[model samples]
Target: MISDPDGTVLALFAAFCRIGGCIMVLPGFSSARISLQIRILLAVAVSMAMLPVLWDQIYPQVTGKGHSYLLLVTFETVIGVVFGLITRYYVLGLQFAGTVLTMMIGFNAPPTADVLEDTAENQLTNMISFAGLLILFLMDFHHVVFSALVDSYTSMPIGAKFDPQNVLITLTNTLSQTFFIMLRLASPYILYGLLFNIAVGFVNKLAPAIPIYFISTPYLIAGGMFLVYFGIAAMLKLFADGFGPILRGL
Candidate 1:
């Protein structure tokens, strides 16, 4: 019943180069906790599902293309990785923000195994990162990424010349925007840390004989924790809100 099975296979692989590339570095899906087999199956399934809709676009470009087909695969995979990096960078920004918050609040608990990855991370950082990621999933952020991928075919079609300059510019802009957003989220804590340390310094000066550093640490951590309890909702909301504009800018 199937016609041109060879061409169909070529087209499917071409599509996989892009979609699978994205999934390879995608946030939740790319976690170290996920087995490689699962990621491969996921990429293949998504490639197949998207193939029908993209048949007219992908099939013609790949079928019977000789050596040029290899070029197409390379460019396609690069484009996919670029798209995945955009989202990945944004999520990593949240992790950076979490680390900043932890230090600011004086929450120097020993680093523990990260909930989502094999790396060790502060408990506070892990909580903030996981919570931000969970909120994004709840809000269906993957759907947005997939939509962007579908739209990318229109913008950067198969066999199109790869533009490293544009890719660099896009990534640079993403980092700039992510840094600004994360800074805003962590600013209050930064301020808290600065002021808290200053006050403690003054107290230590006043009571030189007292173990002021030892006495003040618990209060510093408690105050920071209180701020986190009150401000975490807003922080996550801001983080989630920034994801859309960043992706759309791409």
Candidate 2:
């Protein structure tokens, strides 16, 4: 039923190069828990579904003679990877916040497997990262990511030359913006930790014989937990809200 099935297949492969590459690094999809074969199949399925919609744009490009299809594949994959990393960095920023929060709150639980990845990290950090990722899933951040990938064809198009300068600038901006967002979210706990430690130090100074540091451990954990109980909802809300603006800005 199809005319030029070969061209169609080539176009599909081209689409896959980008979509599959993006999925390989995108947060939820890229989790180590997701088998690589499953991700590959999902990418192929998505590429097929998108093929009809992108047919006109991709078909012409793929059908052209004398163009190195291999080169195109490499470039498209790079572009996809770059796009994926942009979203990935935002999520990684949450992990940074988690680490900072865990350290500040003194939740020095033994290291455990990360819920999202196979790597070991402090238990509290793992918990916070998982919770933040779960919230992002509930909000359908993946939908936004794929939508933006679709639009990227218009802005970046197929076969656009890779710009290291732009890539560097984008990454720098993302890091800076994400850092500020993380800082703001964790600022309350940071202040709480600082003041709590300072006060404990003062008490220890006043009563040199008393083991104030030992005495303060339970209170430190309790106060941090209380702050988290009150502030976690807002923290995640702010974090999820920032994702859109950051992606759009890039």
Candidate 3:
């Protein structure tokens, strides 16, 4: 039996619309700093590539109910956005951690206009965020993202009812996890900073005549830089080990 060309195109386009809009806002890929032309190209590339795999699964489920189709497409877009948001949380975790670290490190740069969100993250954020992305790449975590996109069609069916409560719960849980992971990942620096501050404070108290401010600033700066430098392997290792589990959780 031959399918109606219009119906097939509609189904195909509906699926494409969701996937295209998703990759546009998807973390790592989503950046206004990147040219619109490039984003469109990426959207098209991902949309076309995903269509074949997802179409058979999603097409049958699409009822093609006149204007109801727009509602369905909107739901699809929401699902896509939710998926991107959930998956993007890990990147946001790094940014959050970087933001806190920037404050500690005295790098109070404004969040860029092209940033993914209104995070008050600083210039060191650029470093930490880039480092996080780089670590994700090195750990091959994008494979998990691609696999999750394919898996999402089956997990979240077309025209399925979404629970707003569950969405809120998921977001809350994700933010909590992000903050925890940020502290965990940067524990080395946090530990160093804490101990250094305590010790320096004591030394100043014991030696009231000495300007520990002059003495301690260079030590903390040098020590913090040293720890951050030596800590790359640990950070990347954490990324490698945790990313698969995080993707699976998402």
**Per-candidate TM-score against the hidden true structure:** 0.97, 0.95, 0.84
Candidate 2, pairs of clashing residues? none
**Residue range 153-204, candidate 3, lDDT tens digits:** 7777777776678767777777776667678887777777778888988999
Writing each residue's lDDT as its tens digit, candidate 1 over 1-250 gives 8799999999999999999999999899999999999999999999999999999899989987999998999899998999899999999999999999999989989999998899999999999999998998998888888888989999998877889999999999999999999999999999999999999999989999999989989999999999999999999999988887887755
Evaluation by lDDT, superior candidate among 1 and 3: 1
Shift in Å, residue 238, candidate 3: 0.5
Q: After superposition, how far is residue 17 of candidate 1 from its true place, in Å?
A: 0.5
Pick by TM-score: 2 or 3, better one: 2
| Residue-level lDDT for 172 in candidate 2 | 83
Task: List residue ranges in candidate 3 displaced over 4 A.
Answer: 1-3, 105-123
Q: Name the best candidate (by lDDT).
A: 1
> In lDDT terms, how accurate is model 3?
0.70
Q: What is candidate 2's lDDT per residue for 204-248, written digit by digit as tens?
A: 999999999998999999999999889988988999888877887
